[model samples]
Target: SSLTPRPTGGISPIALPVLESLFTGNLQEARKLVFSQMLVSGQAAENGGSNNFIIGKRNQRALQVLSKSVDQDNCKTNALLYGGMHCKDLHRRLESMGYVAKKTEWRTAWSVD
Candidate 1:
């Protein structure tokens, strides 16, 4: 899925809704729910006979950033700001992955290995 756009030097819009959902509900509970969803969804995919393809290097870095930012101690505001930083990092990572194609094409989508 495509990441949502963030304001320049700010949080991505995609994370905002998640933050809102976390706050309006129980944050830890929400995390547990999301984790469960990921697990169950992954299992469903596996049961459907999907092969476990290696994640592209760029995606691995992105996941790392996400994991670090969305820790249990981080609050909504912290997470929002962290996600902003992570999005910028992801941009650089994607560029290094050759997905940016050209320096001028950073905003456009490109293929991964």
Candidate 2:
């Protein structure tokens, strides 16, 4: 493929794998990004919260299914797709994590760098 970038505008949680690697090099930045993502999860992940994350604004069941979509490939199709459409709540989670989003003819893509 060409060297052209993905038009990620800014950092995105979608690049979790990259961030994880970056952590070894720049621990501060990596921690910041990861912490931001945790906050964005809306789970707060405080001392004693629900400790559950929702997908597609549905229920815990959706989170269960979405987890399946987050395998090695990290394909979010099933997580974002609800009633044959994109899920706002799920997308918001990305936004809250400071991930830049881009809308294309095919689908909404996010990236972080």
Candidate 3:
């Protein structure tokens, strides 16, 4: 099915339910929800609609969390794994925060011919 733009549903559908599960200490349920919603989100990005906008919002939220971890938690090291499409924007954001890439490695999750 071609993904239809549901402007009202950028990420909340997945995030909220997954978050709820996590908050309830249901790690297994949260994991399941993430995979299930990932499929839907992947379809949407592959097929249609404002994918960039959605991805941008997700990246922004992720960075906010990362920032808190660094600033408030005094984290000396952290790892962020996100879709490759988000790298450019994330790199810019990290650089703006005076972060420089120390190393980069690519491990193929899958590839299709």
The better-scoring model by TM-score among 1 and 2 is 1
What are the lDDT figures for the candidates, one per model?
0.48, 0.50, 0.76
- lDDT, candidate 1, residue 65? 66
Report per-prediction Cα RMSD to one decimal.
20.3, 17.2, 13.8
Could you say which candidate leads in lDDT? 3
> Which segments of candidate 2 are over 4 A away from where they belong?
1-13, 16-24, 43-113
lDDT of 1: 0.48
Residue-pair clashes per prediction, in order, are 0, 2, 0
Better of 1 and 3 by lDDT: 3
For candidate 3, the per-residue lDDT at 16 reads 69
Model 3 Cα lDDT, one tens digit per residue, 1-113: 12233687654544766776777898988887778678667766754357777877888899999999999999998888897677777888889889888889998764321
Ranking of predictions according to lDDT = 3, 2, 1
**TM-scores of the candidates in the order shown:** 0.25, 0.24, 0.53
Pitting candidate 2 against candidate 3, the one with the higher lDDT is: 3
lDDT of candidate 1 over 1-113, digit per residue (tens): 23345567555553554565576876765575566567657655653222322223444655556556656546343321222223544565556655443333234232211
